[model samples]
Target: MAGGAADNYGGVFDGSMGFGAKPALILIDFVEAYFDPSCALYAGVEEALKNALKLRDAAREAGLLIVYTNVSYTQSMIDGGRFAQKVPPLENFVAGHPMGAWPKGLEPADDELVITKHYPSAFFGTSLASTLTANGNDSLIITGLSTSGCVRASCVDCCSHGFIPIIAEDAVGDRHEAPHKANLFDMQAKYADVLPSAKIMEYLSELKL
Candidate 1:
């Protein structure tokens, strides 16, 4: 399931589901641990990181509020509960772990926000919602790793909190291609506007605000 080929559906997603303007960028779990092949992460993560970097650059130029989410647990992992138990890889994602740190290439800017989350959804048990609200971000452009788990969780939670979730399809990946494809398809059908990264770039380019 890890190395299987995925059918890339370029330009196939519907974008009308998301907010028309005022978009922000949320990059989730793009950490060294996820990018290292030696760890329990995806294979083509290097390629995904390249796309995410491009997205981040464009968002920054467009004056979008950029937020990065990292999974950091306590030494005992007592705070995460059942979610962390089911996914034992999370236990290694402690605050000081090298794997918990953001990938060097996509490190946060001084003005950007870096959120430490114990759970999958960035909005859950974090100040992400309030931050977005304060910044007047009604729509979110999500780019990250492990699409099936954290990405999907954040998308639904963002929608529930009244923020339109727009997944940068080419900018998100998972430990396995199957879960990536399945979650993208599911998010497209139900929660978020699953658009390719290129299309989102076009929207940002045309923004007059």
Candidate 2:
């Protein structure tokens, strides 16, 4: 028998996209803006950040292709586009801004792909799809800040691109607990598998490499 909220959805949008053989790691917008208490966009996500570090380390050890996404805009912010307009806080990503850099210890390796975008989904107007394709990465292990925003968009786009999206629930954070929990439930029900960080780390560790 379906239980409570599970029954309310009428059995729709309830299936896993599952894992693909070639997995890649995508760290979305894990920058100073979202982590710094002094910054306007800060979310007080230290716990999540620490877990993400563990995930990153596991990915590195497992030899997975690591991809990190951060927003960047012209000094004029003209290239920020509509999404930026809707959320003016995006200006924090402008060139030369203090918050534009990756949070300490979360920095990308010199050889890792660093994708910069002006929008929500990392794939939009970016070379992420082709990069993933070129590297033979068919699954995305995703983490980062603001669960209701960029993280959600990136996962949906990952699914649309035929890449399996595996969202590490403990590795993603939101400024508020409500949206974070809600989006995780919604993504698990529809777009992706929301798993604990330890499970994800174990999966990566057990890969053939």
Candidate 3:
């Protein structure tokens, strides 16, 4: 009999990069475009949003640095480059578009850092890595929309940038389940420590600031 998926890669890919001493919580692209049913990018990820909110509050209470990211592009999408060309739906993120606004309950606090990115990976073409390093953050608690796209990209880059990527599995979602689950499995095996939001919240609570 064949072993289960976990059994197949047990020793090779199952190693854990546990939480680091100084961690930051980053919410990626939890914008109105993903939550509004009328938007082309609507992902119906309300449950994920709820979980992210819980994690955000927990991280805030723990006094961890918090960062929120949103997609924004010039009207002509000059800075968007090939990404905007590949996905025309990105037009919704053009400056001043309603779809680019933050969803009500998920808005970043006044004091929280908000990074406006033009691409999928939050660290790509952005100062995220530098910001994290300067702030002495050794790890990131990552949560956001579209598990397979922005979330996965951010996780990989987080690892590449030498920051531990702790993905809040239930706090990230996609338009469909297949890619979401596949990406989470892949991330766990290669890039990040994929965990449930509740577990992440517990971890945050246990952190010493």
For this target, which candidate reaches the highest TM-score against the unseen true structure?
3
What are the per-residue Cα lDDT tens digits for candidate 3 across 1-209? Answer: 14685688778997899999999999999999988898899999999999999988898899999999999888799999999989999999999999999889877788899999988999998999999999999999999988999999999999999999999999999999989988998999999999988888887788895
Candidate 2 — which residues are off by over 4 angstroms?
A: 1-5
Q: Which of the numbered candidates is closest to the native, going by highest lDDT?
A: 3
Per-candidate TM-score against the hidden true structure: 0.89, 0.94, 0.96
Q: How high is the lDDT of residue 157 in model 1? A: 97
In terms of lDDT, the poorest run of 10 residues in model 2 is 1-10
1-209: candidate 2 lDDT, tens digit per residue: 24886788666866766667889998888899987788889899888889988998999998989989888899888898778788898888888898989778887889899998888898999999999999999899999878999999999999999899999999999999999999999999888999999998888888885
For candidate 2, give the lDDT: 0.88
| Model 3 stretches astray by more than 4 angstroms | 1-8
lDDT of 1 by residue, 69-121 (tens): 98878899998888888988776687688877777778798999999888888
Q: Rate the local accuracy (lDDT) of all candidates.
A: 0.84, 0.88, 0.92
Q: Give the C-alpha miss distance for residue 154 in model 3, angstroms.
A: 0.4
TM-score (C-alpha) between model 1 and the true structure: 0.89
Q: Cα RMSD for candidate 3? A: 1.7
RMSD of each: 4.7, 2.1, 1.7
